[model samples]
Target: MTTDNRSTLFSPLTLPTPDGTGFALRNRTILSPMCQYAVDRQDGVATDWHLQHYGAVAAGGFGLLTIESTGVNAAGRISPRDLGMYNETQEAAHRRLVSFIHSQGAAAAVQLNHAGGRASGKPWLPGTHGGSAPLEDGGWQTVGMTDQSIAKGYRPTTKLSKDGIEQIVSDFAAAARRADAAGYDVIQIHAAHGYLLHQSLSPLTNTRDDKYGGTEENRFRLTREVVDAVRAAWPDSKPLGIRISATDWVAGGLDVDVTSRLMRDLVKNHGINWVDVSSGGLVSTPLQPSGPGFHAVLGAQIKRALADTDAVVSVVGGISSPEQAETMLRTGQVDAVSIGRAAMRNPHWPAMAAARLGVPCEDNPAAPQYWRAEW
Candidate 1:
């Protein structure tokens, strides 16, 4: 998506994607991917909760609604209850959710992820793999670019061999294939929040003397490869996005300079249409500042680095009101703003945001059924 001078957040920006060419969202509001951990325990498939939750968010007037972190493989899930797209059954269930979201007037997207060293727990005994739950509770060994443990007592990861790396890449591509079949308009590769890809990106977590680690390029290799694989498998018309932790908030870890360069290269090479910016999930660091729009600085830094590029940028973290989103977009800090907790609390936040921004209810993206309630 090319950036143009915009007067307000209500203005539309077009995305250059195969299926979404010139795809302009009506507003800047997006329902950020918030994991519900509400899927069928047996198969990790979307159930009634997913349909109703996503449906309400779409009907709430968001221009886009992203399904939470869905695992590409069983072991990649944050929780066994997390949604998965590894098989046909999950794909069929997701199709129903996407259909409902689209019917409510928002484009549907899915966040594909591999929780890596963090894969832990199941539905009944929900907890971290080792600390809170035992292997007998349906946990298993996890993997990462290196054999590293994410926090105290978290499941230790088996360092991914060359074959293991390649297999996961294929897994992501296969998940992309399922996402296409499931009717998602967009796909977001989850490389943030100290997850698999993030652990590889940050020096604090990634410290291997192998092809998949050490240097910045080596650390970035797996994510780039996954992006390439997913792009190849996904349809040309839909947009592919990458969620990134813009900074690790610790010295010698991922920061704006490192992340910006990587993001610039990614957009230039992989045809990524959006970059969702968040921070400080790599390792525990007291340096993580908390406030509304704290991550916007990194988001703006990335946007500036890619000023010549065509990728759209979004910032998430503590963004609560329409005014904040408007200010950020109006000032060119980011092209869009994703509402996380706020959207969860009120699914129709986008519509209310529109009203707060003085956009007429009719002009907003509200459904007819919600016309009177929100308009």
Candidate 2:
């Protein structure tokens, strides 16, 4: 196969940045951010485990690797072991990781998140899958849009006051500054999976009568503010992106139509350059579909909705097979595919997929040292 004959999955994608100069990705495959929960000291700093873990994926040929959920504040972490972007120590560690990823010919992105009511929970490692970590075990009270539990085993959260909400926005902006300092190519604001921003977006979670809740526009206030703040803080040369659960999968909850509108506005008016679509984290419901390429349709809809803009749309689900991913891209379902568990199972997934898709070996995105490794 020749370069011109290469599959869309192996082709480059340039994401538009605020500066008008685009951020070029070597290929269309992105490594979805997955939590490792390996921070030994629980101080929210990246450790050796993080370096090796992300390094492996970078060398594995991903065009972009999104670092897992990182807290903007200590109390906002999903687990004590999750990463944070607030301090000098964490920022330095992240810089080290980004340098290594770039050396391997990959771009690095960090997902800035505030888990809200879901914070301070047990890591999802074996034998400690669910429930909030007790205070004695280093857990703290979580905060949310309302004083409610996001899930059954999670602790009930304190409702965030107007001041608290403002603080949250400030924290995200501060984190964005740190991310730029760390030399990240992109910053993904995590508004999905029932986090603080998602809580405010979903009617099932946000019931406040204040300006930050109730009507759809009011519910969207916090996320919009955070986006504005981060965009203002972050350098215009780097692209800004977001991960959103396109649907809540239950009646009277957020769905594709609403989220599509949000994406359009974010791309057209705000400074978002990319959107990664996922769904159903506010509450567990059977209505949420499952299986391979589950979020492809939603991604396509959002892509079509943002057709007039230069925003790139990606989808994450059971997108394991190379053929399925290729078909999705070839059919214009999404601009890119975010591989999760499959990438974990095989860190060199992109390299192998490139070979399977018949991309010429010289053009394969694999690290130079791995070029001789038979795919």
Candidate 3:
């Protein structure tokens, strides 16, 4: 058999959005978005810490580097330190960061998110949740599908009205413009992990009868609208993707089947490029599974379900070893492997993985280092 050096984890992946936007990654490894919450000014600007953090991961050799979940609006921030895209100052800050990622030959993506009912103060700090933070202490009134408190020790949330819903769509579009201006190559709409979009998608949290709730179609309306808006604003030459909770881990909640279908529809009508699948976190679910590559099965099902489409699905959660990553990709469990906490724990994981999988790190395109970028 002919030997292609781009074997297993080092294989290239190309995804073209339904609207003609595309990104050809040198490998199937993607740096999953993980919030830093490192901005201390409460202004949502990128800091030197962000530069070092993402810079490390970028140099670690992932084909695509997705920045953390950034707030589309100040009021939608999960913490005061979360990155934001609603202002030029924030956009300018990200430009330098994105430049660094690109200088390393990695495609840069930004995850646009709204915390919804979960918005508040420091998540790492104690005494905060659905009922704790006062408005003056860097916490604003949070909004979601309903005004009911998600839980104790968290900010009580206000229900989003029709105008509020429209505003969210506009906000996402505005964020796309800013991301484009900042030189981000992709925009990953964060609709998963019990955030604003997931809060509305999962029936466990959304109990409204309005057009934006009740039926799955209604619950998916907001996310779909945001996708359409972002697609219009983002460049057609660059890919657009969304990160979604494939399963709520509760009976009668949004599951892989529903998520796969929703993603399919997005590809068919909304110009979606790729899907990053992670499960749970919508509500307190005791049934959530935990283990190595625990969520790959659901992501695999989504990938199988979309076999006819150009859309791709990336799986995250509990994936650390290069063998696991290679196996998942070889078996078609996922189009790409995304790493979160593992990447942070070891920014050199990709290069290390390349070595383990028999792809010489020195020769792998994914392992190339542009020290000039560092200079």
Candidate 4:
């Protein structure tokens, strides 16, 4: 295949760093952070399963691998088995994973998160599909922006006090520092999917009357603080990013227009260099669109909104096809496409996508050992 025939999906991208030189990616394919919930013990450490799971994806050819929703503190974890970044042991384990990802010629990012009202839930695995885990089963009390339960099956949360919010901010900063120590090339603050930050962002979830709630400015306060804290703790030379749910897919909830303004502010005012657009995790609703490239329209809206800024906008949600991804980039829908369930089904989705898109065999991003197997 000639260079002119090469797809934009296989093109290199540079996410700007504070230093202005920018961080380079081999391609526009990013592995969306997906929880594995494979930690055998509830110690908040990355296990061998994580190493192998992420290592395979790194070698499979993703330009960047965003690790799953990692807890900034023990209580912030989504489940007892979820990974955490608050302690030295977790930091060291993360360092090991980053080393292997770098060895595979891919950049590594950690999605630092606090589940808030969604914490202490059972893993989304067999038998325990969803809902809160019991106290005897290792679940603990959850905290959130309000005292209400996020969903019917989830436990009601203790509303975070002003001091508690301060502590959560500190925990995020400490986790950012640990991520830097672990040699991660990027830090993606997880503000989406109805987690702590998202819980604070949406009007449906945040009914508080304090400075952290009420008006739009107040709803956005916690996210801004988290971004500022993470940026301060992370290296200036490394890019800082965020993942946000663009809409709640319901009335009186966040919509693209609202989130686009938020993304613009985050990119222009804050130090965020990348924005990964996703939607409808704040609450379960049938209104959330599905099918191939469902979030591309939302991403396009955000990209146009942030046209004046240098932020890279990527979208995730049912983006599985190479042609579909190429069409999105070629048509200026999004800067990149984040592969989730598709990548899980085939870790080497990028390599296969490259071949399908007419990229030369030599230029394919597959592991050398597996290159012999035809795409």
- Candidate 2 clash pair list: none
Could you give candidate 1's per-residue lDDT for residues 1-375 as a string of tens digits?
A: 326533366676666685556566767787899888787664779999998899889888888888999999998988766899999989999999999988887888899999888776443443522342467766678887667578776867898898998999999999999999889988999999888999888888888888888999999998999999999998777788999999898889998899998998888888788899988776877899888877888889988998997788998988996788888987788999888999889988877777787776558777887788844
TM-scores of all predicted structures: 0.94, 0.98, 0.94, 0.98
Which portions of model 3 show Cα errors greater than 4 Å?
1-6, 19-21, 126-132, 365-375
Report the lDDT tens digits of candidate 4 across residue range 277-334.
9998878899989998899889999999998888999999999989999989988888
Model 2 root-mean-square deviation: 1.7
Off by over 4 Å in 1: 1-7, 18-20, 121-132
Error of 3 at 338 (Å): 0.4
- Model 2: residues with Cα > 4 Å off, grouped in runs: 1-4, 125-128
Instruction: Tell how far residue 305 is off in model 4, in angstroms.
Output: 0.3
Q: Rate the local accuracy (lDDT) of all candidates.
A: 0.84, 0.93, 0.85, 0.92
What lDDT score is found at residue 1 in candidate 1?
Answer: 31
Could you arrange the candidates by lDDT from highest to lowest? 2, 4, 3, 1
